[model samples]
Every structure is written in C-alpha cells, then in structure tokens.
Target: MAKADGLDLIAVGRSCVDLYGEQTGGRLEDMLSFAKYIGGSPTNTAVGASRLGLDAGLLTRVGEDHFGRFIREQLAREGVDTRGVVADPARLTALAFLGIRDPDTFPLVFYRENCADMALEAGDIDPAFVASARAVLINGTHLSQPGVFAASMEACRLARAAGGKVVFDIDYRPVLWGLAGKDAGENRFVADAAVTARLQQVLPLCDLIVGTEEEVHILGGSTDTIDALRAIRERTPALLVCKRGAQGCSAFADAIPDSLDQGVVGRGFAVEVFNVLGAGDAFMAGFLRGWLRGAPLAECCEWANACGAIVVSRHGCSPAMPTWEELQAFLRDEARPFRLREDAALEHLHWATTRATGYPSLTVLAMDHRSQFEALCERTGAAPERIAGFKSLALRAVDRVAAGDPGFGVLLDGRFGMRALEAAAAYPYWIGRPIELPGSRPLEFESSADVATELATWPANHVVKCLALYHPDDPQELRERQERQLLRLQDAARKTRHELLVEIIASRGGEVAEDTAARAIERLYALGIRPDWWKLEPDDRAGAWRGIEDAIVRNDPHCRGVVLLGLSAPQDELIASFAAAAQAPIVKGFAVGRTIFADAAEQWFAGTIDDEAAIDDLARRFAILVEAWRDAKQRAQTQAIRETA
Candidate 1:
C-alpha cells in the first residue's frame, strides 16, 4: 500500500482555551483551581479526529501571547496541522471560564470579546490548503461576524470547488452569537429568520450537516425539531444528524425516505453524565472517524455515541476524547458504571497523552540532584551556595537547546532549582521536579508523602520525577518499606492530578544494573504502582532494554515511554548507552545529567570558570549528546526502512 497524503480533515472557525473548574458541584468563585484544556467546537472536533488516527488540521487565529503559543503547541502535540492557524498580534486569545453545578447545567463565561479567533479575516485563510482536505469542517459561530464569516465562506467555496465535502456542525451558542450576554446562561434558545438565512446560504455547499435540536430549529427556520430536519433536507442534499442529548441522535438523508418520523436514530450509550460540554463535538468526530474509513451509517453512529459517552463522563473537552484502543476497550467491556479518574480502567485510557507531532524524541537535561550535587561540591571544597548557581548554569544550557525544537525536558529539585522549575514550565519544554528527599536509600523520605502537598498545587502538565534506589536482593523488611513508601507517592499522584515520572535505579552491588532496573519496574507494577513515565538507567545493549519495555507494556500501555538516565556515567560511556537506547522504540528520550554537565558544574563550583564559561561548556556537552542520540535514532530508522524494503 502506498503511503497516505496528510491533511484528510480541515477544521475551521473558533479555537479557545478552556479553564474548567477542578472541583465539581461548586460555584466558580469557590473553586480554588481550574484545569486548562483546548476548547472550541471546531478545534475539539479536529483534536478528536486526530486522536482517531486521522490526518487533521486546524484553521483559526490565536493571540500572539502565551495562551496562543499554548493553543498551537497543544494542537501540534495532537498531530493537528497548525500551519493554517494564524497568530493575531492585535487581539488576545479567547478564554472560557467554566463551572459545572450538576449533570444538567454547566455555567460558562466567554472571555472572547474581539478575541483573536474571531478576528480571522478572509485573507487569513489559505485557499489551496482549504481545498486540499477531503472534508472541511466548520462551526456556525464564525458566521456571527463579518471577517470570520467571509473567511468561512471562502473556505467552503475552495473546498466545494476542489470536490471536497463540506461538513457543517451547527455549533450555535447564543452568547457567541451576541444574542445572549455573558450572564444570560450558557445554553440559550433563539429563533431568528436572519440567522437562518445566513446559515441557509451555505447549506448547498455542505455534504454533511450536524446539529442539536435547538440548533436545527434555529438553522431550519422552524420551531419543531421534525420541521427543522425537513427544512434543512429540502435546502441541501446533505445528510442531517440531529443530536437529542440522552435520547441519542437521528440522521436523515434524501435516500433514507421521508415517511420515517425521525429517520435513522443511532442508539445512545446511557452514561451517567459528568458534564455535557463537548459531547456534540465528540459525536461529530466519531461519526467522521467511521465515515471516512468507509463504515456504514449505523456503525458510524455507534462510534459517535461511544465517543460522546466517554467525553461527557470526563472532565475536560478536547483532551477527554478517547484514543482508538480506549474506545475499543470501553465498547468491549459491558461492565458496570465507569467513573472518570476514580476507576483505574478508565484512568489508564490516556486522554491526556502528549504524542509528538513535529518532534517525537526528547533530550532531557536532568539537574535535579540535591544531595548528590552538594556532596560532589563539598568534596571539591567548593562553596555550598554554588549549588543553585551550578543548577542555573545547567538551566541556561537547556534554554539554548529548547530554542531549536527537537523536544526537551528539564528535571530539577525544589531545594535549589525551584526557580528553574518555575521558568521551564512556562516554556514549551517538558518540566519535571524531584519528589524524593535528598539522597534517600531504600526510598526513605523525610516525611510521609510530603510531596503530596506540593503535588496538589503543581500544574498538571508538569511531571513529578521521583527517584528510588532499590536492590532486588534486599532484605524483606527494607523491600517492604520501600514498596509502602512508593505506594504513598502513587496515591498522592492519583489525588493531585500529577503525572508521576518514577526514576528506578538499582543499588550499586546488583548483578548487571540494567537487568536489575528492568526487574525493578516489574516489581513496581506488581505492587500496583503504575507511573506515567519511567526514568531508567541506560543499558549497554539494545536487546537488554526489551525486558523493561515489555514490563511497561503489560502494566500500562498508556504509560508514557521511558527516558534513559545518565547515572553519573562518563561522557563516552553515556554516549554509548544512549546509542543503545536509541535502537529501542520504547525509550522515548534521555535524561542525561552528569554526562552533559558534570565537568562544567565542577569548574563553576570550584571558581575555575566564570558563569558564562561554565554555561557555554554545559551547552557544548549537552549539544554533543543531543547530536549523538539524534544520529543513532536516524540510523535506526534508516535501517528499519531498508529492512522493510
């Protein structure tokens, strides 16, 4: 089979940031924290489609600010093409502050007055790119404004001219339409002929039209749902899908006959609704996922209902769309009620897995050691105060590498590198912080789950890097103690919404450290401690990493792939280890510390080199390691391609 061309689906219109209240059944004022997720109808649909292995792209505008960068990065991380998305320097990115009181009602505030996405002009769109997609999906909110309306029409014209299907999701928000103000309720009903005419103008261009009952009523220029469906069908020879919330949905087409009352209604999944924020978008994506793959209407509707069911039972919008494996598993099991975050099965679905789009591999700089770094400095007769300074030098090196955009992460400790932690989190680089007490053997900590307090407040995107030194042949009592301590951290991770990155290193006296490290992960899995990421000691042989990979796959396929740790190894030895790791697909990245910055740290601490010299040296060494890893990964890919040929 020939390789497929990219951009099968292009979604246009509004894209915004959603700040969802973390605490349920509370007023927005009372909620102390909120989780951030990408929001907006068309954006969510694009992300959902991408999650189902579709080549999706987005066309919108975001502010040239932090939020805008976040929107772009998040979309790109999901494999959504963001080249068509523009960064409007003049306007701020749109934001929605939302709270859920119950299953029936969700209070939402649109902070999108003259926002960037709405500022999208006809000139902002690329006609060729719009025409390239097999289907162009557009939301109705863009029709409310002159500039966005013109752009949406141009896109429709381009897609239709190129023999591409135009899909219209009647995403009618009264507040978005300016028919209702910020406080006039999130869900509003308004029937206006002018709005209907505006929508009807593009009906002939659409091959598929999807809308809820109220949305259909508004666009069809009718008060009744049945009449709304008939009116829409009369105008366009498109397939009409009317979503009826818990009653499932009905799809009507000219070929389906008019004698039927509601047409072909897809059976709905009776999930205990958590929040119905993105169900419609999920439904559209699921329908497209099946339809694009040549499935029949009934099967397409099944996928749509399942996708909607999973999202409504979760917290966030776009991020809550289930992966392909997750959807299959959810559909396969006919078990009891599944709760989000509370149930292990549902929690492992990985709705928030950050897949690489432009850059899949990460070259992490691990400078998080507190006790170890202090000890090394003390032995060299360097001032203790230089620990933070050494960390700062390492951070500067990280900054230089991040500028180039082959993914990178920084691991730091709170004792000295807290400033670096705060700084790195703001950038696109992945941020990780050590949770273990300084130099704890057998995984002992100063207090029981002290990191839990910090974990609760830490941003969700950042990783909690916890280290534990364990020996496979250790005494029973010591082994039991370590397991219990790890269990505490695991429980804390579950409660605090932090993705745990556990670093497992074997005790020095063990048999072949790599084998010991592989077994350690299996032991952790057996103890029911499944982390999102594993930081393992580098292996000398490529095949030696296979056991570790197998253990991770068995424990949690959703587990983010492992990263190779430096283990304070010599530069040449560490480079060899990284070369070996590059051959394993499961080793997603490397977290080499001493190999990248040890000499520079020593020189800076001993006052042999100035801060700038130390920083430049660290950057030099880090870059060399990065180049080595990239070369190895490239060679491995080439070998695989040759083998296939």
Candidate 2:
C-alpha cells in the first residue's frame, strides 16, 4: 500500500489514562503512589508510531473533563493529529490501575464502566477523515461492544474504499468482552466462542493482523498456535504476525506453516523484563513504521521485535516507547546494556526529546524579590500585608504587555505573589515560582527543606526557578553544601515533572574570571544536574558568551537556551548587553526585574505614586526591554542568513 498525503495511520479504539503503581513488586492494595500516563492498545500504538516519525492520528472519545483535555494536549505534543478525538459530554474518560507484582506478573484493573471511548458510535467516524489516512488500525477490544463495533466497522469500510489498508490488532481482553470477572483484568486469554465470532466479523476487512499466541488462540478458536494460525488464515487473506514473548515474532503472509518456526521469524533482544503490559502495542507500532513504507516482512518483524524488547525492559507503556533517534542508537550499539532503565544516555535522550513544549524566545519580568520587597515595606512605612497587593499590580502590568504574545513570562514568588500566581494560572503565559530563600549564600528553600513537598502544591505549568548565590571560587565546604542542595532540588523537579530554571550568579562578591559562568555551568553538569533552563547574567565579551554556549552544548545539547538576567543594571546598559550577546544563538531571551520595576516599586511604596502610575511606569519600561531584545534578535538572524549565503 502506498502512503497517503495525510496521516500514515489512524488508530480507532480505546484511549484512556493509566495510573501505574510507584512501588515496584507490590500489590495494588498496598501501593501508596501512582504515576499517570496515557494508555490503551490503540492509543499506545499511535503514540509509538508518532515517536518513530510517523504522522499518526487517534480516533477515540474522551470525556469533557480534565483528563480529556490532558489526553488531547498530550497527543498534540507527541505530534499525533487529534482531529478525530471526540469529547463525549455524557461519559467519563476510562482509567486503568496497573501494578507490578513480579517480572512475569502484572495486575491491572479497568475503570471503564460506560467510559467515553466505549460509547463511540458509528456516527462519530467520519468517512472522509478515515480515508485521509493510509491505514486504520482497529483493536479487538473496540469490537466487543455494539456501539464501538459499528464505529470500528465503519472506519474499516471507509479505509478500504479509499485504498487504505485495514490493520487489526488482536488486543484480546477477556474481561472487556465479559468473558471473565471484572477483577480478572490481568487474564490474557479465555476460551470463548462468542468473542471469536465477534472478531471474525472484521477479519475479512483486515490487510494485516497482529496478536500474541494466546490472542491468536482466542481469535482462531484453538489453544494450539499452529491450529490457531491456520484457522484464522482461512477466515482472512491478511498477513498474520504471531508475537512470541521473548523468543521474538513470526510473520506469515501465505499459507499457515506446519510449525511456528516455518514462518519469517525475527529474533528478539535479550533484555530483563520489568512489565509486559504495553509491549504488544509497541510491537505493532514498530511493525507499521516499516510496513507502511512497503518494507520486507522480515525487516518489519525486526523493527517490531526491537520496539517490544525496549518497552518490556521499561516501566510504563506509552512513555517508555523509544523515539526514532533512540531506537537507531540502540540498534547500532553492540555494547548496549541489558537493563535499559540503567542506561543513562538512553534515559536522558527520552526525557529531553519528549519534552511537552519548547520556548524559542522568552521575554520574562522577574519580580521574585522577597527580602527586597520586605525592606521596601520597612523603609516606606507601608504594611507588609500590602506587598501582595503590589505584586497584583505588577502582574497587571505584565498582563498588559503580554496581551497578544505568548513568549512573555513571569518569575514571581509564592510568598508575596500568591494572588498574582493564582491569576496567572488562568492564562497561557509562562509562569515561574521561586524556591530559593532570598540572598541565601548556601542555597536554602523558602519553605521546607523538602523541596518536593513544597513543589507538590504548585501547578505543573509553573517552572521551578531557584537562584543560587553560587561562585565557582567559593570555599570547598560551602560549594559542596550548595551543590548538594541544588542536586536535591533538581531531583525533586524531575520527580514532580516540573521544568527547572537554575539562575547562577558567579560574581557574588570577589573578582570574577571571564569564564566563571562557563565553569559554573560545567561544574553543575559534572554533578549531573541538568536544568531545563539557565538564567545567567549577560557577559560583555563575545568570547565569554561563546565559552558558555560551548559548555552547555558539550554537556547537555538538549538544554533549553539561556535567558539573560538583569542584576539591577541600567536600562541602557542592559540594552547594550543584549546587542553584545545577540550573536550567540544559545541566548534565547531576557528575564529582567529590578531594571524595569525597582524605581516604580520604590515610588509606589513611598506613596509618591498611585497604583495606576506605578503600573504604567513598569509596563513602559518592560516594553522597552522587550523591544530591544527583539531588535537584537532580528539583527542576529539577518547576520546568520548573510553568513550562510
């Protein structure tokens, strides 16, 4: 089958949220915490295909709620088209609770009573939309219910009418078919003739069929693998792929062979299994990646086997699937480790490549001043309680400037800016909250020493901004303590899935070297603390900026570019610094606070100016800096184009 102009694959079936137990080798009843991720057979396949550089789309329904929005947003982030994902207002999104009991045992519970995905009716499938994709994958679970069965059949009809292949993943779940008890979700197979009849109705419409040995048994009506393959072959002329857990997989395009080894077999990798929940989905995704391009069946099975092997050694399903680059690296590395989770390079590659968003340029107003704000209240005789109101006014100024642009951000503190932060949550602006205590030499958190506990209360969108009064030349004891604290904070950020921005001030007190900022960043990399962003003071020398860029690229190429910080410098000086650092592509944008707000804040606190006046003055100053940065960025782009020419 030739590829279409639109999506390469459209997976029409179950899409739900999966909450995996954090405590490994434990029962679901004893688990204390869980991590949420997108799940379901077809959904996982779509995500896996998208990660492998396929233009995949999902045809499913989710409830009109938080989880629904999350599913859509995550698919969009993964580069999967969500145009066919419907939000059913009447039903709640489906959820699956999974636990890791042992290497071979995984306990699962499906919370899918009248779920939105299952409620998908035939009317939901658009004929034109189905034909736009080169292939439509329908899972067996979606064919169990009448409503979804009609929808799946409609998609299969539309796909075939447009000369598109219909791929059927025999994702057999006995509980989903009412053949097993509700709590028997972990049961992979049950001998049921009714379920086979239902699945057979869609077999002739399929061009490709994938299933495990047990899944084939359920579909082909026999416990014997060869008998199941031959029985299913008689029902459909599609190619059959039998997944044999660790031994690998075999694909049969013609007559069923006498033995399982008589087909085109692909060898599987030798890796320790963690949870075998999503391996089949990963295998199907990888197989399609090759098959859609008209690759040989042997090669397709190889890709499928590798994907399954990688996923089986990881934790969750969709999140654990390998990216194109990661898969290539794994395939090329002869010395690849047996434990995929312990491979730091592969883990970092996955984490960096799968980030939700990327900010090309950010113009932020940093007003996370705690000690400075308190001191202003002290000097002006204003009540300390009024600080919150002042922060609200400042946020208004930022809102006015960020009316149309999404690149604008704010660095506010929870202590005095809680009201502003709450307001910012309603918008799509980049908002960061400070964690470090003001002017702390050895780096102390504002709230509890347990940074993760403090971060647990924060919104996921809020970036964790921590300012360290760290100098590369500090005493060994002080530097080590600060480094330890920063490491702890970084760990917490990773655990909480919050983006981290580490603001470094290398010239805290003594004379600074030209390469101090670079060395400071290098030191952090050596300690394995890679923040998503670095907030650094702009350097006057081009060479200094180059050194910093080299350090970042050499250490963590996926690190988000640096954002220049203003240390209360004059507006003109700050503008000049922007021009000086403009040539460095590593610098994304600026986050200046005191340079824009200090004077107006002082005037407002002293009662020399009213709220509007203070807000207007701060807004005007902020706009000036934003314009300066943009002008410099444009100039740099023009220079780059000229050099390339």
Candidate 3:
C-alpha cells in the first residue's frame, strides 16, 4: 500500500448550518444577538488540516439547499477535498442553533432529525479515499442513526483492514442522542444507558479517542482521568486523550507507549479568548499536522494546544486558524519578549506570525472583531433591550475601559482602530470610554493638555485600551507610531491615579492557573500597576456569579468589587459576599457595551427632573459617606442614620 501523500486525512461526520450568537455578556433573558455561519466538527477538522498545508477531505451528507452549497463553497475555499461531500435532494440539511453564553463552552440547540448529514450511508464514503488517507475521523453524532452508524463502523473496519489510522471524536451531544430507540422520557435521555452502550460499542474500533471531560465521565463513569483511561483501555486499546478546555489535556497511551513511560499530560496554550466554538477541531487539525510530520506525541499535543489557543484568541473555529507559515512564526516568536504595554498585542503578534506563514481570509479578522455579539443577536433575534442587558454583563465581566469616557480611559491599540472603540462604545452599560474615532481627536481635552497628558487625566476612573497595531496594509512608519502611542498609554496608566485595565483579547490561559481573567490581572500586576478591578463575564445561567466568586478567591489582590453589568444573578447571596469581601460597592451597571455612557448622566445619575428630590436625597446620603470618611465626629452619626434609612 502506498503511504498517504501530504498527510491525507479524511474527516467523516456531520456537516451543518450553524447560527451562532452570544450576548455581549452571558444572560439568557438578555436579547440574544448573533450571526449565521457553517459549523461542524469533522468538516472544521478537514478545513483546519487543509489550512495547515495538508491534503484533507470531508465525507458527509448535506441537503441540496443554499446552506449545503455554502458549506461546499467554504470547504473548497479552504482547499479541503470535497469529492466525497454528498448532497441529498431528499432531506433537509442539519441545522444547529448555538448560543455561546460563555466564551469557553457553549450549549447548542440542534435541529437534526434524519437530517441530510445523518442520512449518510456507508456507500457514501468512497473506499478509494479511505484507502488513500492515513487517518479517518468520525463523530458519534453520525453514528446515532443506525444507517450512518453502521456505515461509519464499516468504514472503520475497512480502514483498519487497509491499515489506516482511525480516530474518534466523542462529540457527544446529550440532547441529540436521547434514549436511542426508546420514547423521549426521563429515563430515555440521550446521555442515558442506550447512548453509553453505543459509545462503548464504537470505542473498540477507534485507535484514538478525543472527548470532553464531561463526555469522558458520562461514557467511562469516572471523573478521574486515570480511571477514565483505564475504563477506555478495557474497551479498546485506543490512546485516550481528554480535552479539558482551560485545564489542558491528558493522554493515556498505556499500559504504556513510546511517547510516555506511564501517560502523557499536555498543557494547553494560555490565550486571551474571544470565543471557543471551534477550538477542538483546530486542535484536531494541529494534532494531525504534527502527526503527519512525524512529530513526537508531545509535540503533536503542543500543536493542538497552540492551534486551540490561536482559535480561541481570535473568533469562529475555521476562520480563526493560523496558516502553516503563521504557525511557524508564532512558534519561533514564542521566546521573544512582549512589549510591556500592549495587552492584546501578543495575540495579534501570534496571528500575524501565523498569517505570514499561510493564507487566511480577511473575513477571519472581521469575525474576530465582532462575531461574539453580532452573531448572538442575529440567532436569538433577542429584544434589543435584552441584547443590551446581556452585552452589559459581558462588558462588566470583561470591564474594558474606553479612552474618552469620564470614568476611565482605555489605551487604544491601533490594531482594531475605531472598530474596536466603536464595538466597546456600542455597549449601553460598560466601562467603555469614548475614543476619538479615527480622524477625530479629543477636542475637549485639547485645551487642557497634550495628547498624552489628556489621556492620563482620565486615569483615576478610566481604563486606557490601546490597539497596538494598525491596518495590516498601513506603512511601517504608521505602524511604529501606533506602537509608540501604545507605549505612551502604558506609561500613562502606570503614573496616573486611575487603575490600568488592559484588555488583551487574544490571550489564552494555560496550566499556569492564570486563565484569561487571571492573566489579565497578572499582566497588569507584572507592570507594577495594580488594577482596582479585573473584569470578567461569567456563564449566562442563574448561578453565573459563582465563577466571579471563584476568580476573586483565587486571585486575591487589592481589588474592589466587580462592576456587575447585568441583571441580578439568581445567586445574589454569593455575589453580595464577593462585594463584601472586596469592600467595593457593586455598581448595577448596564451591559450595553460602550454605549452605556452616552446618557450616563441621565440614566445613572439624573433619571428625571420630577425625581430630583429623591435623587438629591440619595446624593446627600453619598455626601455624608464622603464626609464621614473624611471627618470622624460626624462620621458615626451620619453612618447610623444612613444605615437606618
């Protein structure tokens, strides 16, 4: 048999039309804004491999609808071989509505009933392609349907017969596999016994297994990786690799393999994240890239980590991947020191290096810039107010300081320019400071100080956000000027009275326990400047505040209460405790991005003239606190009255 040329990889499974939208922050009641895009694990994997300069192919069924056409076009554009991509005129394509409440893990709403993709039969997978490829990837979702399931098992049988490597991604959608043949009931949930049995049946045929921590626990019945590995080992000799999102991954190749004496644990790349939708596919692509090049298992795992990091730091899965040249550049530049000031600059550098290495679409940049909010709103068609509410939550969690706002100023890293500022500005309630849009300068501050001096004045209450790089086509001189401005802003943040909160939107969290939020705090701390608050958005559900509580406890510092930007969490007690611990008043800020301050005086401060008396009374109460903090004699009496009132 001829060894596969240029790393032939065949990814077989679901091909879908995905409509993804996320609230600017995670809130269910918030109007969900979103965008539609094509997404599926195996299809994405194929695209990723092709982007890495490998000969990758996708094998799945799609309806002969516009969505199907779009999927084919995307695959072709990405240079993936789609000869085996079947279009069924008889059935509708699988459509999934994904709501990414958190940037890390998202719950999906899938509409897939005998869907076109699930209509795949073994005959649809060409034997020649399987024989030609070195590895074949399959999804458990496809196997949920008996025909597709039989087809995949048969394909694996043939691939094994032909000596090809077989990989299984246990993309277990609990909602999708509910009760197999049983009626939809409590006992018939997809994650029930039936699905577990199906998973067990398929594991023996796979040489490698990739799954989420939850999937592992469900299928293997253990939380411990070692025990899970043992459970998997008993079913199949396939190497077990558990993808643990931020915690990194662990692979058990033993009883023992050459790669590790006992087992292999690979730490994921620490990245500033935007969305984690397709990082898993990116990881698969990276792992294949390394494997094809005869890279050590450890190195393969590193490739996966780096690829996943790159994807999360950017936006959607396939769109955010780095080209081969870009990947090399990032690897080469890993050791280089980051300019102390640019927070998201390092991630941009990573993307830049990856872009230099291979071809990536400009759409990726656009997606990264705005997909999180835009996509969510479109999907949910959420009421505008709800959308604003959710966005405020995300903004509060992230707490991005804007440049022109009265409370705080952001350091503008010129990379995203006005677009970044505008995005921040759109938030109705956030720390987004106003930025002089491109070609616009701070005229108000022009009379009082120089640009740097003016920029620093907002330091006490402002976060200076800077985009360190300019348009990709900008002249080197222009780019250098932007970098210099970033440096100036950094310096200003340090000396000014304001807390410097830098948003490195592209960073990733690794094994260092410094996840994006932690890293953001750490980055500023390393600069010898302490931020009054490190912002973040927790999950959108009722108990989302727990995450903030955990982060606060983990990264204890001289930080105040988090400026919560959304509705009261169901777990208000936990959040209140955090507020008490931080000794910082939890401001019920809006989640409308940077737009929050446009009418800040009216909404947050003024309200209406008719209520002026009440507002005045509230103001007087605050005055007493300020006075009490200053004067001891009247302090006690004022405090007592205020508390009683």
Candidate 4:
C-alpha cells in the first residue's frame, strides 16, 4: 500500500524517547537534576546515516502524544526523513529509561510491551518504500516484540526482492529475552524460543550482519568468532562485521574462498571518553559512509573505528555525531592497519599511534610537584624548554591540542596557582582542583589583595569548578560522603560564579552570571548556545516511581521549560503518581527512572565522584536507561487498555 521514493535508506522497526540521568555518585532521591534525550537503536542508526549526508528515512510508528511529536521533530532536525514515520492514534510511542552510577562499566535496563513501535504491521511499510532504499537497517530488538518481528522480516525480504541490500545489527539486549518476572523462568524460556526462531529466519537473508563479539557468540550459539562466521556464512553469505568496542572491529567478505578462515580485524583508535552512548551507531555510520563512497572493506573498518573514537570523545548521540567532512579528514590523517597486541608492546604503541592519530592527543598534564610534571613531560617526549611551571605547561599543552584537536578537556592541580592557571580554568578548557577566589578564607589564606582588584583580575567568562572533596580511593560510606561533598562543591562553585557575576553587575550596573555572559557572547558572534535556560525535576518525593516526559514548553520563546521527574512508591502506583504530576499543566515529558532500571536490570547503584571516566560513561547510560523506561511505560499503559477492552 505504501509508495517508495528514491530514498537511499529506509530504517524499519522500533523508535523511542530515551530518558536518563547520572545517579551513580548519588541516588536519584539525592539529586535535583536529570537530562532527557532521544534514543532507539533503529532511530539512532538512521540519524547517524543522515548526519553523514545520507538520504535516510525512518519507517516506524510513534504515539499521537507529545513524546511522539518530539521524536518526529528530532528526526527532522537530524535530517532524517520522517514522512514515512507513521503516528499511531491507538498506542503511545515506546520509551526507554537508563540510570548510571558508574560510567566505565555497563549500565542496565529494559523495554516495555505493546509500545507504538511494536504495533507496526506489514501494511505500515509500503512496498514502494522498500523499493526505494539502497538498504534497510533493522534492529534485532524488534524481533523480540510481537507484530514487529514478522513485519521486519517481510520488509527485509521485500527489500531484497526489490534488489536492495539488507543490513542487520544484532543489538542483542540479552535481558530483554531473559526471564525475570515471578513466572519469569517459564515466560523467559518461551520468549527465548520465539525470538530464537525469528533470528534464525532473518539472519540468513541479511546482506550484512553487524554485531559485537558477545552478540555474535550468543547468535551463533558459540564462543568462537570464526565458528560463528562459518555458521552464518553457510546460510546468508552476508558480510559479517563484529564490532569489538575499544578493541576495534573486524569484517568478513562473502567472496572469501575459505568461509571458515578468520576475516580482517582492525584495532580502534584510543580515545578518552566523555560518553559512549552512540559509539556503535557512529561506527556503523562511518563504515556505511565509507562503503557508500567506494572504499574497500578494510578501509571501511578503519573508518568505523575512527568514527567511534570521535564519538566516545564527545557526548550524546545525534548532537555529538561527526559529519562526512570530519570523518574523511580523520581518515586521511590517521588510517593505519596493524596486527593487534597487548598494551605494553611496540605493536601496541603502533596501533595506539595509528588510532590515536584519529584523535588529536589530549594530554592531562597533572602534577603534585614540579618534578612529577617534568617527569611526565620527559615521558611524553616534550622538550624541557616547553615545560614551564604548571600553568604555562598546561596552556602550552592545551594550545598544541586545540591547534590540532577538535576539543579536549583538562584537569589542572590547584597546589600551583600560577597566573596562567587562573586563566586556564575559565572557558571550560581546564578543571581546577582545590582552588578558590583570591580572598576565600577557607583555602588557607593564599592571597591578600584589594578585594575589588582581585575580582577584576578573575576571568569573567570562566566556568569556575571547585575541587571534589571526596577521596578517590574511599570505601562505600566514605564514597557517599565524598560524593555529597563534591555536589556541595558544585553548588558552591555555582554560587561563586553567580555572586561574582552579581558583583560585576554592581560595578557596571548589569548582570554577569556565566549563563548570561555565554548568551551575550553568543549573540555577539551570531552563534547559538545550547538550551540551558531550563531544568527537569520531580514534582514530589511522595513515591518511588518517576515518569520521564517531553520537553517543557515555555511561554517565552527565549527560555527553555523546566523538565519534570515524577516519583512514587512502586509498581501499580507509577501511573497514578504520573497522573498527579500531570495535574500541573506545564509538564513536558514524564518518566520513571529508578523504577524502570530496577525492573529492567538488577539493583540500581549510584556512581562515585572519584571515577570521572565512569561518571561520564554512566551519565550517558542513564540517558539510555531513561529511554527504555519511557518506552516501556507507554506500552504498558497501551497494553492495559487493550486487555481491559
């Protein structure tokens, strides 16, 4: 029934809104903030492709609710064609909620039943739509859902029949199919059986299968990569790409004589990460971008790694994505092939260098003493003349990095408060530890100057950060205390920035808050600042459940609305809790974070402040976790109505 245009790609299956937050260093109950972002594997990949200048369209369903509208708007903004993204009057869009306490390790969560995306039928995907694309990228998660499994396989078949390629990413959410309810053992077994059957049917027909090593093992029913490839090759003979995360990625050509022989594997470039949310999608985007540009399979792997490296260095999914020009430039400068090895070997350094080239080297020049700083310089092969005291040295390093690197973060020690050090802490270029304004008495009375003179010397545009008071190696209770302390420090830093701005205003009869300064600066350059005018928070602490919702709309076009996070006691109570919050007319989106994470995964743990890497990773995961929860909540509500009727 559907007609297809000359679309380059049509992404079929599920799409949902992702609601998440960083609670690891602290519990949700302890925090006053959360972030809402868009998520859904198929949606993510489609957007990734679009950001790289591909003509990609999303063929999916979302509810006729605010969440649905947000999803549509997001896709349109990302340059994804949503003309085929159907809206379901009967069901709500799927929602996913994620929570992370520690970002370095994995954060866990799940999907809900009967969401709008799962209700997609064969008729929803028009035959012309399948005919229009060069390829159709499908998510394995859809196969676990009801009508979607059949609809997806049929779409794949139709696409192939119409001479289009099929790309399958085995985004295996194991727990999604695992047993968990009171009768979870039996329910999970049955669900696993149904999913396994669906997978067996779809995989063989795929032109390309992308998955992680763990996913390949699970799908192949074996631990061995080669064995798994041989098994899949026997059926579809499709190109197999096994993504190895930080290790990089590998691929198998269908034309290779020995199907059993291991295919080419490439190591990923090393990158310090701010988040790993959409790294996989970024990889797929790069690989496809390169493949579409006529690069060989090996080069495709290189491109994929480079894209992933760039992604991890940044934040969020679509917003953090790199364009085609960025990827091409990175590849031209950094692409190298080498045999993988352990970290201590020369082969390792060679690999690291190649991969590192893709990322401009961001060195964190830290020192407890001048000698330690000098030693680091020696190790990094920096000339002695370049190594000044802590501040100059850090500035030189930042200049070197910024000249070649897109942007990098820095942490400067507070013990050495050089004049340059004060300057570096401004503009988010460096994070200063154990430092306060010149006259702060709590910091051991370091400087005594005319208070006004000192105020004038401070960087007006700098984002002042207080040193975290928590010990990095403390135990549980101690860690919690440290976390609380750091939060207080964050609060203090915010206050200091505000007070200083207020002081500046008193002197000049104007406002000087950092946010105000940022906006004023952006207006000068005709550049747009991110939407920081509003925040999302819980309406009440009366319950344990929370609802993640759509963005709050403000009457003023210049300001963003406050995000609402609703909490209630437990299950059978979240909807009611959300209903209470909805009584207030301005709430944009509703979500249940801890409730969903606990239900989807295991017990929820808060993150520790000591682990910055983990904090970053966990923050991103929380976003994904929130997405799963919102999706599940809508589906559960829709299913409840279906059953009652």
What's the TM-score of each model vs. the native? 0.87, 0.96, 0.52, 0.51
Off by over 4 Å in 2: 1-5
For model 3, residues 1-645, the per-residue Cα lDDT tens digits are 226352378888888877665354554335354445567889888878888878888889999998898889778767888888999999888887655455544555667877898888988877877887778898877777798898888778878887888999887765566633322211112336666677788887788888876667656766654565667778888877777676666677767344322456664556566667788888888888877667788888777877777777644566667677666655665553332113443433333333211211000001112233344445545332333333222223233222222332222222222344445554422233432232211112111344455554342324443322123233556534544444455455543433333222221212222243443334334434333333343223323344334544444322443433211223333233333222222221212222222222223223333233333433343233223222432343465579899
Kindly list the per-residue Cα lDDT of model 1 for residues 437-501, writing each as its tens digit: 76677676543447577677677767788888776667788888888888988888876777788
Note the residue pairs that clash in candidate 1. none
Worst 10 residues of 2 by lDDT: 1-10
lDDT of 3 at 20: 60
Off by over 4 Å in 4: 1-5, 22-32, 178-194, 255-262, 329-645
Query: Which candidate wins on TM-score?
Result: 2
In angstroms, give how far residue 392 of model 1 lies from its true place: 2.0
Model 2 lDDT tens row, 260-316: 999999857888899899999999999999999888889899899999989998888
Candidate rank order under TM-score: 2, 1, 3, 4
Every candidate's lDDT: 0.81, 0.90, 0.54, 0.53
Alpha-carbon error at 209 in model 1, in Å?
1.3
Task: List the candidates ranked by lDDT, beginning with the highest.
Answer: 2, 1, 3, 4
Error of 1 at 95 (Å): 1.7
